[model samples]
Target: MVGCPLTWQRVSINETIAPEDVAFIIPGKTTLAEIVARLGAPDEITSPDGRITYTPFGLRMITRTPQVITASYPGAVARYRFLDFKRFRANFTWGLKFIQPVPGIPDDFVFESGGIGTDEFLVVLDSNWIVRQHAFAKHADASRYRPWPFDLEPPDDNQVVSF
Candidate 1:
């Protein structure tokens, strides 16, 4: 028999979201203003890499009565029934600069990352608060890869003082 192309199946693929990553669960009715009033401004705002999201879910209930109870006027035994439903969720990203910054970076040096899908979005804006350029993923095949300026050097202030 002729050899067949190898097939790989991805099983148990899971998406890991950061604990602090803000995800909007309610759309439209909720706005950025409400978020700001409740949770202050984001640490950083990334133009061209912006994102706004919204989601909504609903709950419903149902009741049933037995036919035997219907015959008996006001006072009769009634059977209660209940049914639960799975929660629904919606997600959407509005057009705007990706506003927010993830801390834990050393102040002396800054960290940048490749555009979307290259691990968590950690884009760095220029001094003028404009997006300069997006970094590319180191590994194309994988979902995530390292970005630019991975290594950094500490500033040198070693100069002899004149007496």
Candidate 2:
């Protein structure tokens, strides 16, 4: 009951993938090289045969995943990274927050809290290096800036656009 919340907003990193981008990828028609040209290099590529078996995750490297990408045959997983902090802030909770301004505080202080999110688009390729499967497990969507620290309504932050 002292400081008033000043700002509320979403933050993001990198560029997000669009549905139109996915449209260009055909399971049999889309080749690995074509995807590379359209979406750039993948953040992590997992080979079922273990040619390049290592995959890095965060500060520490993890071997079992990426953007939730995996397949049964010789293929590749392409990950597109996008930054959206506003969406990131909504996904995780920071516990209860002060909705009202402090009665004793002289100046209004904004919650000024938020973080960036990693929006990913993963494309799984087949043995022929053609797109076998893909999805935007994390589709970046609508967001807003609020004065309250906590969202009165659930934020449309974590969307799993599976296809």
Candidate 3:
């Protein structure tokens, strides 16, 4: 059998998104069309049980009709389970390193891989959509975290925290 030589090249992938670029996407006010316009078409769109989901940078925006009803940003907890210490350690170390330069980054924030892949995010919906809920499988890939515009602020000490 003839042998083939293998070569590899190091490629740098730069994502141009700044936190401010997506800051304008308000949970209740931002429409699906606005999202498509600003972020450019999503990588995927899924409609299940009348709810539409758009995944961009692994960020999920669920909607019904053409308006955005809910937006879910990725978080570390979903990506790092208690049992999966390797991922948990990687995510935690990343978080620590991230906070030093970006002091405003929240403790709950996570670094998620962008582009097309099945990753999850912490889903927080408007009060109106409180009834809708999805359960994660025991072995489901935990939510991958992405930095959102709003999460850039240091949480208020007096604000009641809920996850």
Candidate 4:
């Protein structure tokens, strides 16, 4: 099925389909009319430099499994105690226990910045749209963003250095 409920029966029976393919992918360089045909009217329209942008709400489904557990016993338990009043007391017990579906840390977390799908993608743009001066950032180095206040000069010209 192309989709879950409304099975878009165009290409194949069970083959999965990308959401972008159904929503955005056109045969070739598509125009406004083709866009309206494939995807319905846009939520917001913008025209800048004679280029039109049709921004629509992206579809997504969030799923999560709440932590839980299930346990069972093989048989019942019976305890019996006896005191002889001379040496020792005797006790007996029997039972079985089992636990299933242990919970653990989540495999994937969605909170981190620069996440895969969280970033915006610039679609349908010419070569001139390529960025020349991109904002570069050093991820882990704090000094890259903030220079040291003191003048920490490099070693003298001919000074010997040891590791």
Q: Number of the top candidate by TM-score?
A: 2
> Candidate 4 — which residues are off by over 4 angstroms?
1-28, 49-163
Better of 1 and 4 by TM-score: 4
- Which prediction has more favorable lDDT, 1 or 2? 2
Model 3: per-residue lDDT, tens digit, 102-156? 6576443333232222322222333342212222223223333333313567878
Better model by TM-score: candidate 2 vs candidate 3: 2
The TM-scores of all predictions, comma-separated, are 0.17, 0.55, 0.26, 0.19
lDDT-based ranking? 2, 3, 1, 4
lDDT of 2 by residue, 1-163 (tens): 1222233455455456788877888777888789888777776667645444433222225554564534555565666666565511231222224343445643333354344444677777777788878878663443434435576888788888998
Q: Considering lDDT, which of the candidate structures 1 and 4 is the better prediction for this target?
A: 1
Top lDDT prediction, candidate number: 2
Q: Give the TM-score of candidate 2.
A: 0.55
- Candidate 4, residues 1-163: lDDT per residue as tens digits? 2112211111111122234534543323444444446544333222223232222222212346552323332221111111111111111111111232335633222211111111121233223322212111212221121122334687689978799
Clashes of each: 3, 15, 4, 0
In model 2, where do residues sit more than 4 Å from their true spots? 1-11, 48-73, 87-108, 113-116, 139-144, 151-163
Candidate ordering by TM-score (highest first): 2, 3, 4, 1
Work out candidate 1's RMSD over C-alphas: 26.1
Error of 2 at 124 (Å): 0.8
